[model samples]
Target: MEHPLSQFKYCPKCGSKHFNINNEKSKQCADCGFVYYFNPSSATVALILNDKKELLVCRRAKDPAKGTLDLPGGFIDMNETGEEGVAREVLEETGLKVKEAIYQFTLPNIYVYSGFPVHTLDMFFLCQVEETSHISAMDDAADAFFIPLTEIRPEDFGLGSIRQGLVKFLSALK
Candidate 1:
């Protein structure tokens, strides 16, 4: 795979061709005196358990891992808090309104998008919903449903951070 900075050949500030690598994580433009840093994007992952203790899971509709299992969450939008992002993601993907979101933990991840590895800090949350019915897979989810915790397998999750989070979550249950 190419370096993340390989695609950026010009400086964004002045559109100059003198952009050069300043460090592993940043680029500097000799002509414009501008520096750009590559930072991980913030993302959220929800671990919603129903009263029956079944976990909510979604089938991915797009690549990076299409057809694999995933949690109901995505990249946080600009100016949105992590809690708000998780709630919005749950509602968007599963049509479930989150009543509350309790932050669990975070894991670094690499989400490859369009051939570029997008670094992300994935924040996990234990979310409670106002209701569990009326679920329909929308947005990027191909399908959404609840499975008993016993049925969950970490290997079933395609995203690395998600799989690690699942293991941590399940272990904590004991």
Candidate 2:
């Protein structure tokens, strides 16, 4: 609801409001002459389904997607392979240890930092959680649970990422 950097009156380095909003996050500084573009990182996610055919979902607490439903995921850290990132993200966000990975697709997504070139690649997979018996919500999730596939709708999805993944996944099932 609020901009992450809305409180700054000046740049931390130069102390000037010479930077104007390119949309919500980006700025072109007329005074300090700096290119402070916030580029996005690659993110990976897994769509988990239990024996009951319910789909696992998480409520996001951080931005780029706060207060939305999402498959467990986050930034892909440096030196981490795409599979490694997906594995780590699932454990960090859902406390579920995933041992198997099936690369589904890689999507190039563009979103306005508020409305400006914040582009990121979102990688998705369908994973089988190894430790379902010990599953719990971890870092970024306010809550986590399994919802029946019929219950998943556009609003239940955090963004186009999960929705797109789910559509393909369900279609394949048919």
Quick one: best TM-score, which candidate? Answer: 1
lDDT of 1 at 146: 97
Writing each residue's lDDT as its tens digit, candidate 2 over 27-131 gives 656687654655566888788889988888888776656788888876789999888988899998888888887898877765445544346788888888875
Per-residue lDDT value at 103 in model 2: 91
Query: Tens-digit lDDT track for model 1 on 66-173?
Result: 999999999999999999999999999999999999999999999999988999999999999998988899999999999999999989999999999999999999
Clashes of 1: 0
Candidate 1 ranges with C-alpha deviation above 4 Å: none
Clash list (residue pairs), candidate 2: none
lDDT of each: 0.96, 0.76
Per-model TM values vs. the true structure: 0.98, 0.70
lDDT of 2: 0.76
Clashing residue pairs in candidate 1 (N, C-alpha, C atoms within 3 angstroms): none
